[model samples]
Target: METDENIRLRQALEHAAAELPPLPDLAPLAVREGRRRRARARFAVATTAFGAVTAGALGIALLPGSDPAPATPAAVPSSPAPSASPGASYPPVVVEATPGVTPPDNPDGLSPAERERRAAHQQRVAALLDELLPEKVTGIRPVKDEVAVYRITAGGASFRMAVSVRPTDEPLAPCPDLPEERGVCETVAFDGDREAQLMAMPVNGPDTTGSYLRFSYGKSRVLLSVDPEAVSAPVTPRELLDVAADPRFLDLVEDTDARPVETKEPRPVAGG
Candidate 1:
């Protein structure tokens, strides 16, 4: 397929190649190319190092405080173990018995209408207490069932429990000067507008004992007392607290029917 023009071009190329001087040594060129590649690599490494230093400097400048030590990972708290029983979480707590007795105090001179209302309310509360009392603590009986007062005895434990509900303008009672030797008394904030006082002391001249939990809920105040000596198993502070915080009690306090009648002066009830 070679044409006349192709043959002429091929001859010209061979003549030019023969006429040219011997090819210069190519070792120098190869060495120069390698040097160029090495230089480029060095420049790239230096650029990368400079960029890393600049980024670190900028990060330090943007921090809020002065140069600080590197932060460590925070410790994560473990989840609490599941409780075996619902009551297991609330362990038994017994307030030690002490000497002397503090007779129950009553607020007197309520009007007959108020007394009637209180009596009805007391009966309802007694019913509630009977229902909520522990199963083993049996034979729940009311000794003195009146307006705002309930004295109850359970089983043959030989202990008496009294529950009293009344009206109070104050959210909390001031802490009385209590001696630690006698017993422990604590005043704690129950909620936003309510406070509670818990005292465990001896009753009936140290032979018997009592646990008193007094707390305010909404517009009403409640006092719960349990004589330890009257029962085989004395009620614990935990139990008292649980009872005080019962939703049913709060419902009773908020109930319109059970609300106390506000009166300026106390009036005596004929048979109250």
Candidate 2:
């Protein structure tokens, strides 16, 4: 019952979403760094998340670190605007009205909510990054609001893992929400259940009162939580450490950061 004009409008919108630029090459780091990260005790976790977890190895370019072109530095800096898609990675529940990345929303693969959930989950993933990493990192940069991109190497996998601090607004368009002070901090922590490494602490000054850790290795780095009043917003580092320390994060972390990895190759999602 849709008008001919409506059909054209929808097709146009779909094409817009599909225009996303290709991901910047994320090649792995050198071999020495990879080995150091694997030995890190942080690799010991429970693996409760299963399918949701990401396990990978390094082969070529960069992980999450390499400095993005100024235009798109953090979070795939310089990435061409996404080509509007008729369908996101997954289909929406209401197929009749599913408009990929368009407004109104769709439940498909990378729905706004799904993207937010995946983004938030990075908190846990970042924690594992800190825990399992033993070598140096490089290319730590800010992406859209509340998010950052790190380039690290471990477990024979060279790649970048985008990390975040506090929960950000759900809208996918805006990101790299830099705090008012606009500073960096580094913190490190490790408990029996978790381990974390932080760098580029998002703060203006050094902090000690609250447990915030920030540090960098090459380009891959971490962001930790800093008492807003104490200095700046650093929920990134704190969350990552906490996630890494979790007993369930061991296997995932090990597989993610271990070098000369035996197994742990990530199977692409069904259609991904």
Candidate 3:
């Protein structure tokens, strides 16, 4: 009894239903997907926070006026300064000693006390000579077994020097008068009537050059002589006279005059 169009419509509906696929539950799949999405989002947030912290630390380190962390310093040892040697200013004093040499005659036959006194005085005179003489004179030493005599070393040569004090009453020996014996002589006048005679003469004949000087003190006659046989340039008469005129030298003469060093009888010149 149904119409033809209605029957055809029912058949089409049955065919469509038969062709459709069966549906499954979607709850587990949706839960798994949501957990995966949340995990990915947490990882992205952690990465962003780590990057920000790294950049901030770098910026602080690179800042222009910021002080860097201090490092430990290494240890180092210190050294001491150099010190000066002894007797650096003045040249050394040398004493000469020879074995088995016949000691020169001690004509004065000075007693132990007298010899001691003379030795002390001679040392003082040697010190003064070292100060007053030219720098070329390297050293002055007393002659062995001799009084008032010194050996001067200068310009790589040895010379003889004598300083003595005697009674003023004893006349100063005149410079040689004979042509064969005479030398150049001159009288130097000092303050007041004080005068000194300076001479350049021969030592062992006319061929050698020597110097002699004499001056009168209060009551004493001080004599100084030099024999520059080997010296390149001998001490000049003017130099010798200047030393004689020094007040310090006069003081030494005064001491000797107060206490006589020579006997009334004349003795051979010292260091002759």
Candidate 4:
């Protein structure tokens, strides 16, 4: 017996046939059309049966309060469309700083505690900067007062590091007032080869308030970065350190003879 659905389908087919395109061979075309329609009906019926079976299985598996385990959801079909990742929003991160205790200064203007504290503080900062690994470098230069600088010039950007000797018996460091986002003291970073480290620190006043940014790279973890001028402010010590430890970029480290990159203050992140 034809179901109500079949009756409705017949009426719909008649309506469509009345509107079909005119063909020259009516009888043969009609026969072909009938075959095509039957084939399509069979395909549709198979597809519908498949869908119903799938739905029923899913429903049985997903039944709530059932003693049996739930069914796993089916894998979504791959689409030609591209989708963005949620974590992609994390900006190219550089580093995070950790504060520490500083020691008192030695006579002659510097204390052993001050130097130790500053060095320790810088170390923490460097650890953070180490996160800036896998960076590209551009140029290297030597500076005055036993100093050198490496200039990084890639990754949609430009940055420089200054390394110098810390006053052994000194009071405060002899470095200069870094521009914004730079610090007189900073942390360190390890190289990809884990061979060398670059160091940077600021030469600013105690009242310095804004966040200081600095980094150092070294051959081993114990090596205090020989380069202090390499430091920049307003950046996490880690990123700057990443640039230092980068080898190809290390060429930018002045050969103690290469032309020095003109000194400039650290710039602020726009609308950051």
- By lDDT, the best candidate is 3
Model 2: lowest-lDDT 10 consecutive positions: 87-96
Candidates, ranked, TM-score:
3, 1, 2, 4
Q: What's each prediction's TM-score?
A: 0.46, 0.22, 0.56, 0.20
Candidate 2 segments exceeding 4 Å error: 1-186, 192-196, 199-234, 258-272
lDDT of 3 by residue, 1-272 (tens): 88999999999999999999977789999996786456345434433343243322212111123221112111110110112112111111122233222333444576756655555555556656755665555656555345556666555455668887867565666644636666778887875678888888766756678888887776677778888564323687788877777667766677777876655435557899
Model 4 lDDT on a 0 to 1 scale = 0.31
Better of 1 and 4 by TM-score: 1
Q: Give the alpha carbon lDDT tens digit for every residue of 39-102 in model 4.
A: 4454334333432332222121111232211121122112201221211110111111122221
Count of residue pairs whose backbone atoms collide, per candidate: 4, 87, 0, 49
Model 3 scores worst on lDDT over the 10 consecutive residues at: 72-81
CA shift at 27, candidate 2, in angstroms? 50
Candidate 3 to truth, TM: 0.56
lDDT of candidate 1 over 1-272, digit per residue (tens) = 99999999999999999999998999999997786456445434433343243222212111123221111102111211121111111111111123132222224666545444544444445445544555334333233213433333344233456665556565555656556437668887664556778887666555555777877655556677776543323675556777667666556555622545333223446699
Better of 2 and 3 by TM-score: 3
Q: Which pairs of residues clash in candidate 1, taking residues 3 or more apart in a chain or in different chains? A: 157-230, 158-230, 159-230, 159-231
